[model samples]
Structures are given as C-alpha cells and as structure tokens.
Target chain A: MNQTKFSSWIFDSFKVSPEGLGLYRIFCGLFLLFFLLPSAGIYPFISSLPHTFFQPPPGPMALFDGFPSHSVLLLLHTMLILSICSMTLGWNTKKSSILTGVLLLAIKGFVYSVGKINHDFLIIIVPVLMAFSGWGEVYSVDAFLKRNMQKVEGWVLTLLALFIGFMFFTAGFSKLIGGWLNVESQAALGHVFKQYYVVERQDFLAGFVVNINSPFFWECVDYLTVIFEVGFLLAIFHPRSTRIFLCFALLFHFSLMMVLNISFLPNFLAYAAFLNWTWVDHFIKQKAANTEVKSVKHKWLAPVVIALALVGGWAIIHLIGNDAVLQADWGLAGFIVISGSLPIAIYHLFDQLKRWILERLK
Target chain B: MKKNTVKKIFIFFLIFLPLQYAAVGIIGLEKSEPWPAFILPAFQNVDATPEDVLVKEPVLSIVDSTGVIADAVPSGKLFMGIHESQIQGFFRAHFRDSTRWKGKNAEARSWLANRVNQLYPTADPQSVNVRWINRYYDLSSARRRIDSTRVINEFSISLRDESN
Candidate 1:
C-alpha cells in the first residue's frame, strides 16, 4: 500500500466521534456491571482454596503470593463494582476505566492462577486500552461538569481493531499448530465431545450437536473456524469490511454458545468499539440540544445512580451463588451474562432493521 | 511523545506480543502459561467419542520415609462440592509449570508437606509427589477408565523443625 493508503488504514478507516466513544463507554460499563461483574462471584470460592493450590504466572503475576484471602477477594470485587459504576456513568472515565481494568485483571489474574485461562483477555484489556480513547469526553458526568474533555481520536479505534485482530490471529495460530488443519481431526467436533463428555457442558443445542455423527460436516466446521479466525487479521487491513467480519464473529460466538454452551458475550463490548457509532452520536447530540444538563443541579444524581447500580450488582452477585456461577460457566455461558446482554442484542437487531428500512426508502 | 512514535509503538506491540506468546507456548507445551488468553487451542482434538479422549488427572501422594502412604492428601476436599478435575488444575499448574516459577514451586511443595502433617499429625511426611493419572473417557459410554499412572515429578518437603 502507498503512504496515503497506509495512513488512511490507521486513521481514516476507523473514525469514531466523542459521543460514539461515550456510547461505547456506556455499553461497556453497563455490560460489565450487570453481566460481567457477577461472574467474578466465583473468585471467592477459588480464592478460598488451600494456599498450596495457588499458581502465579511468570512476570508481574509472580509478584503476588497467590490468590488473596476470601475477604481480600471480596474487597477487590467491591472496588471493581464501584469502578465499573464510575466508568459506566462516565465519571472520571479514564481513571475509572483504568481502575476497572486493573481491578478486573487482578481478580482474573487470581482466577487464571488455578491453571486454566479462558478467553477473557479481550474484555479485561479493552477498558485499559480505551481509557486513552477519550470515550468519556461526551455523554458522561465529567462532560456535564465541563471537565477536561477532548475529541475521541479515530486512531485509537484502529489500534483496538489491530489488538482484537491479533487476538483472533493467535487463536488461529494456536489451532493450526495444535493440528486443526488435519483432515482426520475435526477440532470443533472434538471440542463438542470434550465439552459434552468430560466437562459435561450439555446445555442449549449441545445435546443435538453432540449427536451429529457426520465427519464431512465436522471437518467443514473445523476448516471454517480456522479460516474465520486467521482471516480476521488480513481483513482488518481495509477496515471497511470490519462490520462484515464482526458479523461473522457474532455468528461464531453465537454458534459456540448454542452448540457448545460456551459464551464469548463479553467480546461484544470490545467489538462495539469497531462499529461506526457516528449515527448514535448524532442522535444523542440532537437529543442533548433540546434537553439541558438538568441533572447538573442534582449533585447527588451520579452518586445515587452509581449506588443503585452497586446495589443491583450486589443483588445479581448473590443471585448467582455457587450453582448459578457454575451454570453461568463463569459468565462464559449463556445463562447469567446473557440475561444482561439480550436487551442490547435486541436493540441492535431493531436498529439494523430500521437502518435497512431507511435505506430502502432512500 | 510524538503521535507518529506512539503509532509506531502500538503497531510494533501488536506484532510482537502475539508472535512471542505463540512461540513460547508452541515451544514449551505443558510449562507454558496461557495467561490473559493469548492462545486459544479450541479443543484441537480428533473427532472421537468421550472414551477415545485421553484425559490426565493430577494426583498427589503424602508419604513417609518408607515410601508408604501415611495419610491421604484429600485434594478433592480442599474445595467443597467442586469437581475433582477443577481441583486437579491447581496441581497441574504448580507441578507441570514449576520451571517458570521455581521459588513459588518450592514454596507450594513445602506448604503441601505442612498441609499433610497438619491433617494426619503423625504422618511425618518427608516428600510429596504430584503425578498424572492418565485415563480415557469413552464418548459413547460416557465412562472413564484409568489407562495408567506414572510419577511425573517430585519435590522434597522442607520439614519444619519439630522442636521449634
């Protein structure tokens, strides 16, 4: 590509207004508060394990003694909820986003210390990377108070696409190395079997998927999985086709949820950043023009709302309990987290329909 | 500092992080850390029934100087009402990947020794062995059979001075 094409690839291809960033901030914040936060409930149980079981990773993770005591883990959970609330409300967004990421990373650090690491790195790192994206510049409590607001740079979204693309690339690389391309082996079918037989994750369509004894169908799935993952990096070079790629990813996550009972719902928040939220920013800006920042008079509004969010998060966490957390599969399944995510999915569907109708009329 | 430099850093980072992660993991099989979800294996298994899938269960032994089982480690009981396989992950992470964090490895081994003695009180355990009990899960039958058991690695327990 020429210099101009390369420059446009990083800057022009991924343009997001401040309000778009704010909308994404709201989505991410609420998603973590309502859907993602409850998954952390399992930390108390994992933390309570005998100290002998603690396995810290190499590098910075080695600095820790192990998973903290149950009390400390609960403290981390509380701080996480608060920061998530602050971040969602767009109050001190950068700091709150950073804090939210660090807290979640720390808690999840302990969670992964047990040996198995789930694909939750995307959700954990999004807030940290995006804290620099000026997401809190508009539609936030800080913006209302006229804090240090700035235009949300388009470059950040481009960078995020790169990060997310590389994540998927690694998955494909790992699978290729692990023998997913072998004709004799169907990784997807084998995974379905593993989930069913060993882990016993027979939820949703898992029962039906487990019964399909066709080698051709399973092999096709294996190839498609690798292609979709590996193709993501190459596809992102244009960024115009990102929405199409993201649609495929949505289908991929949904299939995993339906067939294997594995949910990557949290990734939707990360994917939201890549979407063109310019329409949302325009709509919200139009609304804001008529309606003054009325809540500015009510100094307690942010705190009251955050406190209520905290209460809601607390209630959700308790409702999760041991069995619920297990059923939620640490919020990586369609149970607890999906309850919080379904509304957003429904909204997106309606929005897409509206856009299609509008385009037809035009 | 500059916007151009920052962009270069981000670009460089994206390339470096995944390549290094995949390289380390591919080279070091069991010893590698899958932290922060850098690598996604996605089951990478052959299409086989549950029985055909061979799974390894990590087992621990608390033995005396005579190589006799003085008391059971009861690793399963550590986390109440949790799956044994879930608990086995702890053992796998500690022993299989010990080479990465030697200090923590020794610390965990010694702690395991103390735990054994604490439970039995009179076991006088000298060392601990965290080994893999290989088994197969028959997919059609949904049943598991122990194929074999072998000692993977052993660590000497830092026995506390009883007089102290």
Candidate 2:
C-alpha cells in the first residue's frame, strides 16, 4: 500500500466512537478512585509527623523547600478526592479529570519523596491522556447536556492498550535480561520471591510460593511468566488476539495476587479499555428486555455495588483491629485475593442474574 | 495532537519495542546507572547476591538530654495505616546511606526536638537526640543472629535553638 493509503488506514483504525472513549474514561476513573480511598487517612497521618519527615520527590522538591503546612496538605488531599469523584460522575468532567491527574502526580511525588516508588504510577497516565481527548463527549453529563455525538480519534484507547501491554512486556523482559530465562540455576524467581520474604521480611502471601516443595516447578512457571509478558504485544494486532492476551493477563495478575500478594486491578481495568464492549452491552440489553426491566435502572448498579463492597471490607478490616491479623502471611493473602476477585465476580453474577430473570420471563 | 501525527508516533513506539526494555535491563544490571523511573530490566537476580553485603538492619532509639535511652516508636504504629514497607523505607532512606547520614540525622534531630516540645508543652527538654543502631544479620545462619557488632550513630538538637 502507498504511504498515503497506509496513513489513512492507521488514522481510521485509531478513531474510536465517543462511547468507547467514555467507557475507557469511566473505567480509569473508577480504578484510581477505589484504590485511593483507603489512603485518604494519609493526610492526618502526615500532619502529625514533623515537617522534616516530608522529603518531597524531585519535582515537588524543586517547588518547595519544606513541607507544606498541615492545612494545605489536607486541602490538597480533599480536593484530590473531590476531583476524582467529579471526574467519575462525569460532572465538569474534562477539567475534573485533568485536576485528578495533576493531584495524583502531586500525591505520588509527595509520598515517594522519602524514597519509595510504587506500581500505581501507571494508573494516572491514561486518565491524563483522556482529559485531552473526546472521552467526555459521550456517556457523560457534558454530553447529555450538549447532545454531542462526535467520534474522537481512536488513538486514546490504542495508547492505553499499548501502555498496559508494554508495561507487562517490559516487566517480563526486564527479568529476562536480568537472567530470569537462565535455566541452569532458575534462581531469579527464587531470589525475587526471597527479596520480600527474607530481605523485606514482609510476607503476607508470597511466603507460600517461597516455601513451595517443588522449586523446579515454580522456576518453570517464572520463565513462562516472562514469555507471556514479552508475547503480550501480539494483542494489539487484532481484537481476537487482544482478547486472548487480556484473558491470559488477568489470570497472570490473579496468580500474582495469590503468590506475590500484589493486585494489578488498575492494569486489568486499563486492558478492558481496549475491548469492544458492544457484546457485553448487548448481553445486558437482551437480559433487561426479557425481564422487562429498564436497563437504565441498572446503569449505576455496578459502581454502587463496588463502593459498598469496598466500604464494607474497610469496616471489617478496621473492626478486626489486630495488626497481626491484617498483616499475617495467610490473612493478608486471603484479603488481597478476595478483594481482587470479588468485584469482578459480583459484576458477572449481576449480569447472569439479569439474564436468568429475563429467560424465566420468556 | 494531530490525529495523523499521533498515530504515526504510536506506531514508531511499538516498533522493535522488545529491545526497549532489554536495553534498560542491560544498563540496570550494573547497579550504578541512572535508570528512568518505572522502567525495569529483564533479569534482576536478587537472591544469588550475597546478603551480607546488601542488607543492614536498622534499630532506632531516642536519647533524652540526661542520656536516658528509650525505644523509638515505630513509624507504622504512629502513622496508623501505612504499609509496612513505606514505614521501613522512610527510615531506611535516612539510615542506609553513609554520605547522607548527617543530613538525615539533622532532620531527625529537628523532629525529635519538635516531638519533645509537643510531649512536654509546659517545659521542653533542653536537648533531645536520636541514635541509629546498624546491625548486619547473616541469612545463611540458622539463628540469623547479628553478623557483626552493633554500630551506633547519634545526633542531638538543643531546645535553645528549637524555637528557630
């Protein structure tokens, strides 16, 4: 194909409907907000500490010589939460999304200033990009008020897919280069596992993997993990391949949650942004029709259920009150696994129940 | 933000992408290179390395003006919901590196001064000091006892300058 034709094809493929971007925006917002809820108490915690304890990361370090006053930190955190809520609710969404992104970056810098960076950094990038796109053009209050139905450039979703795909691919490949693929010793996974278990001595779930009877089996699985991650890029080539890769990725993250006690739900949700959810929508509609239930009645059902589950889980954890129970090897592992799987399981159950009710009506 | 340009750039980014992290992994293996945040190398062999050279256990204690010693409160208990790693990392950042030890100690001194002031609002302590205990534990041992003698580092702050 000629260059002009190729460019046109690429442009056309990257153009996504307003609904697609809006759905992606919603997923990103929900994942970030939910993950951040538990950390809301951090403001008061920081306030009680000495100002010297606040070692702002490089960017913010340049901006301020000392820690901001307690009132300012509290104000910033409150605004962060409020903006996240506004972004998710699709009210003044574009600005709110941008504000949320900025707040996430600022909070991350503040938290990491003292010398620890975490995996949640990837979560904000997609939302920041969404702010600049046409995501708020549909399935949003702005869209509802304006009656806008314009198609946005599809690059936004594609970019999100690439970030998720490349992130895992990079993680896996990084291990490979560090000699994870070296079969002679198969010590890479053992050492990585030992880092948290032995060095950090903070084991909640991975201790089981550390104590596994068959070392060779886990080593082989580690190699397979690298292969799966490196091979993830194939998903971007086609929808079917992307779906297949996403399934494997979800399983991989679920397994990681069990063994490593780490949950990558934000990455999983970002992966969903790449999928054409028309099929899921059709399924919901068909079920709603059979049951003679207005689908709009259930539109807000998923988010409401998720919020309730999260609040209930937090309350239970607080009531338990034993730090040992919350941080024990088995206890922490179980909590992560249940928390990670529960929402997805509940959503599926709700969908199936809706379908079952419609079938009975038929 | 032109649609055509964005599509082309993304295509370029995905081109030969397997080598992108592969290169980063190679650079990171040496442990001295400045790595871009969020990038990881392919093989990070953590266990095979000798733990004696890599790990140091930090024990913190507070010493009052009269030299009375008391166990420093754990940051996790104080913060009341932070991950264990965050609490550890916060202190580790202060204790681990020798070059920055003084600066970190000065900061600790300021914190201890403020803490003492808060605890004794009626009469602040004349001096408050923080003592850092560094001990190395050999993982290969069955008991995991301290491999070396405990090394003590101390920093003090005076209440006379606390108002400043």
TM-score of chain A of each: 0.80, 0.74
Model 1 whole-model lDDT (C-alpha atoms): 0.65
Best lDDT among the predictions, by candidate number = 1
Worst 10 residues of 1 chain A by lDDT: A297-306
- Tell me the DockQ of each model, to 2 decimals: 0.26, 0.27
Q: Quick one: how many clashes does candidate 1 have?
A: 7
Evaluate model 2: give its lDDT.
0.56
lDDT of all the models against the reference?
A: 0.65, 0.56
lDDT of 1 by residue, B1-164 (tens): 35687568666876787676766575457554646555443454454432354544455566666885743346644334333334545555555643523444444555555556666686676665555444454444433333444544544333443221
* CAPRI verdict (incorrect, acceptable, medium, high) for model 2: acceptable
DockQ of 2: 0.27
Clashing pairs in 1: B49-B139, B50-B137, B50-B138, B50-B139, B51-B137, B51-B138, B51-B139
TM, every model: 0.72, 0.71
State fnat for each of the candidate structures.
Answer: 0.32, 0.33
